[model samples]
Target: MRNSSPPLEVGIARWIEVMRRNLLLASIVALGVFGIAAVVIAKLPNVYRAETRILVNPQRISDKYVSSTVSMGPAERLNTLSQQILSTSRLEAITTELNLYPKERQALGRDRVIDLMRHHITIDLKQSSDGPSAFTISYTGGSAQEVATVTNRLAASFIDWNLRDREQEAQGTTLFLEKELATSKSELDALEERLRVYKVQHLGQLPNELDANLQTLSRLQVQLQANSDAQNRLDQQALLSRSGSYDASGEQGENPQAGLRSQLVARDVQAHRDLAELHSHYTAAHPDVISKEAEVASLDAQLTQTPASVSSRTRRSGSVASPADAQETSIHHSRDHLAAEQRQIESSINNYQSRVNGVPIREQEISQLLRDYDTAKEHYRSLLEKTYTAQMSMELERGQEGGSFTLLDPAQVPDAPIGPNRPVLYSMFLVASLVAGLLVIALRERLDSTVKSDGELHDILPHIPVLGLIPRISKTIVNRSPAQPTLRRAS
Candidate 1:
């Protein structure tokens, strides 16, 4: 509080007074900032965002493995496939359809507005912590309604496109499987027809699995033929035995060797030849008669001792120890030989019949095999029919193009301005004002310099002559319109 204060305070007095002339510079800075901000706010267009949502569901359709002849259904493979479809070229194609690009401002035909348009358009896919079962897709743009419209259109279009693609695939698959089914059916039909004809020709015979049956039948037939042959041999022996009494000249009853034997049995030979001695010595019905009877008994006993199935006459007449018995014995010997040959043939026929009894079981097995073949053929035919039906459905679906994706929602008018963020604008203005105030103070310090009073001027250049000096300007500067009075004199 000394009267002179410090020398430093006096030195800064002129600088402080010069710093106060800051009005004009502040006005200039304010006007410039305000003009630029107003132009930026007026030219900028408003942008708006809109959104839409939908749910997609899947369904089931099969027995064990869900066999399909055409393209498989969506529900069968939706999860992984749907995601792949979403992020594919199919989605990019939408951009082409929508013509989403900016308009240019240059003389060149190129568009600068396209860059701004890109900034306006935004596509976002939202996932949740829950699961991958569902997701959301959103789009934002210059207008809220346009965003909603595009989202819905894209969603519908993608669905229709997916359907069309499936239909085409189905048709292709159907055609391929159909050809196979047709060929298989043709082959099956041919086989069945041939089998039918074979059965008809063979009469109750099934061709499939018939080798075993045919073999068994052949063996039976052979056995029957052998039995017939054996029977024929037996018959021939029987006929030969019966015909032993006949001569070889085809006569029914004549025996050439029987002549002498007949004579030996004849009453005249016995009476005339053997009676010569008897007539000389004995009367009829006396000792001679008894002796003749004894002789007849002994010859009959010899005939009875031979086999009944053979010719006893031959055995008994073959050798009468005397010459009187010789001629009749030869006929009996031939009869006995024929009877033995007949017995041998009969034994052979019996042995053959015993060896032929194992042929019915094999025939039954062959019949069963034929049944199995028929069943398999039926199954093959059924599959062929189903495949054909599927092919037809696929073809129909393929023919239909340009499916759904209809306009559920279209573009709409926007309501609010989207640019020139207000809080940021005001904040910028406040900062500009502070900077302008500081700059004005600095500029005024350079423009105003005074050495008016005695003490202040003597502070520096004290030896210079002090003439009557101009006083420092202490009057308050009032801001006014340019048309008003203003002080222009130098200090």
Candidate 2:
């Protein structure tokens, strides 16, 4: 039969026997792996991390007093600042100024150096109930002092960029509002000018002047009626005088002076009525009221002068009196003046009637103008208020009293390294070495064909019986002297 090792089985004894046979190989494998791990771990450089905390300080002034135009929250603000401060140009400048990453800059070039710097920098936000109230800037580097310095520099850059960005935003907002306010003012002025021109173009037909136009029309009508009445009386008197049947004693009176006095009194009464009506409608300063007052004064003067003139004429013509022809001529002359006055009044009435007729159209147009004017005025006022608030916000930003970032805890040089944990790494490698050693032993045992135990031989041929076991001798007679030639046999 072909000699071969017994089939392997799941037994502790078999594994123990196999392990003992390959103990030296397993030890060598384990020691080799452990040694390499230790050496590599020991040679690795130490990395130190330095951190700085920056608190997002809220606005010092109350929001009610002056609202900030910059409405970015802390996280968003930090993100924006990170973008600006961590740009290639900015990082390069900082590296050049601080003389960081000298070897990387020399070997990896400018771009690679900036990339490495960004990789080492970390911005961790710290949140609270309110929001992101603070954040920590961490930088890992080979040197302890270098990491600390870089972290502080990054924090400073972040703070400066935040301030500058916010100030620029505020200034821009103020400038924009100012421009808007100027535009609103211009529009307001244009509307005001348009209103003035419109009022001038339609003077007496405005909504406000409707009452005065009606009053003037009524006054003119009254004057026309009074004139007509006087003309009728004069015509009746002329007819009576021409027929030689005129009564000299009546309400008009018997003499020309009395008739003149009566006409003057009637005109005074009508003037007073017009004045009272005007007073009811308008104030004393109104044009219509003033005109009526003037008319009343003129009537008074005429009434006063008529008596003086009548008395003077009576004395001058003590015997020779006013003749019928003279009286009739005076009456005709008065009738002619009344006729002319009536025509003038009629013309004025037509003009005022046209004004009253056009009132609705003018009123509608004026209402639209007023509505637009009011809207524009309100808009201008609102813009003015916003401009003022924007100015105040700008001032607040300039003063650094608005939302800003402050260095809460400055970065300090780390006392110890944080990377390359030696003990833990050593333990991990020790366990891995054991696993590798066991795998090597199992592999060597699986490939070996030598049958070292009778149990394995019996298991391979279970149907056959094992009669005896051989105990091999350690010494051989060939290697010793021939006189000591003895055979060692197994039972």
Candidate 3:
């Protein structure tokens, strides 16, 4: 035969009766637990937290003209700064200065003290929509004033560290650029000197002189041609006058006649040659040819004016005629002068030709030197500009005009402790005590398996039927003396 389970309402009613019977014991246990919890909570130390807010300010200057040297963002910079500030040395210093963790330092030594201090320091970054990133630096301590002081000090330290870091970076960059500028300037100066010396050494062969050289060469060539033509005409005229007829073939012999007529004919041939040479080198209206023609006409007039009888008389005497001798001497002197002039013109032509031929070579060499010089100059100028910018950046950093930290909210002394919340502790103690009381009652019930109700009995024996029901007598009534002699019987 299977046993039947008790009904839900009957089980609940039986459990309520069992709890009523055990109420005194449960209350004793609950009160004891509550007392212990209260004592433990009271013994815990209170911890106060103080916080300060700092803003990461952007640079005052625009990035377009002068850029900031500090490139790290607020988040990255905060991480780095947290590491540095929380380092053992820094934390130890802070601990010593603030007189923090006296008991912990004594129990766990200085290293643990520093570690504990670092653990208590918190850095939380908060970014805003319109402003730069702001961060909160908070520290937990036993005393509110001490916590506030420590937090403020830490914030100040961060500000100082940021300033020193940025200034050092900016100054270092400036120094580096200054050194580079010096080197560039030196190089530029050296190149300038090299170019100057090269120009001096190769005076006529510089790229800048190319046009002037070409013009000079052209003019010299023209003068050379004119001089050569004049010389040739003079030679031809001398030959023609001596021979007394022009030779188209350029073949002529000296005249044997020794008189004024010979000299006159020589002079006339010279003049015609000069005019022809002028026509070859220039236009028909040349000044030199016109002047020579006029002289030639004057000479012809003098020749015609001389009497033929006078010449015959002189020829008969066979003595050298005075006027004819003078004429011959003059003609020889003029020829010598022409020869010297031609030699000078030839020398000038050779000089000009040599200069013209060397132009391309000089141009190539000068172009190479100038190319190098120009490159150096450009590099020097660029470095100079950067040097100026670096100097300005350094100054800006020194002035604290670049990205920096500003204390937005100074650390304040907290009025209340942040930890060991009393109300929450009391509430938790009450809940825990209630749960403990319920567990104890449940444990006792489980240990004692005897049936306490009719329903439990029914569950144990479903086929059995109750024959009778007896009322339980109270212990108080049985222990009491008989209503005693008051005895309703005697009454």
* Candidate of highest lDDT: 2
Q: Any idea how many clashes model 2 has?
A: 0
TM-score of candidate 3 relative to the true fold: 0.71
TM-score of 2: 0.72
Superposed on all Cα atoms, the candidates' RMSDs to the truth, in angstroms, are 18.0, 10.1, 9.7
Where in model 2 is the C-alpha error above 4 Å?
1-22, 95-117, 245-328, 451-491
Q: Which ten residues in a row have the lowest lDDT in candidate 2?
A: 245-254
**Per-residue C-alpha lDDT of model 3 across residues 1-491, encoded as one tens digit per residue:** 21344576666878899899789878988999999999999999899999999989889889897887667776777788888888889988888877888889878988878878888888888878854488899999889899999999999999999888889888888889889889988988988898889888888766667678768766755665565555555555544443332132122232223345556655765665565455335432458856875886786687567543233424455776544445545655775676566556545645655666677898888788889999998988898888888888888999999989999999999999989899899999999999899889998988988876666677788778867565655667656857744643664
What RMSD does model 2 have?
Answer: 10.1
Candidates ranked, most accurate by TM-score first = 2, 3, 1
lDDT score at residue 190, model 3, on the 0-100 scale: 88
Enumerate residue pairs that collide in model 2: none
Residue runs of model 3 more than 4 Å from their true location after superposition: 1-6, 61-67, 103-118, 130-133, 218-347, 449-491
lDDT over C-alpha atoms for residue 459 of model 2:
63
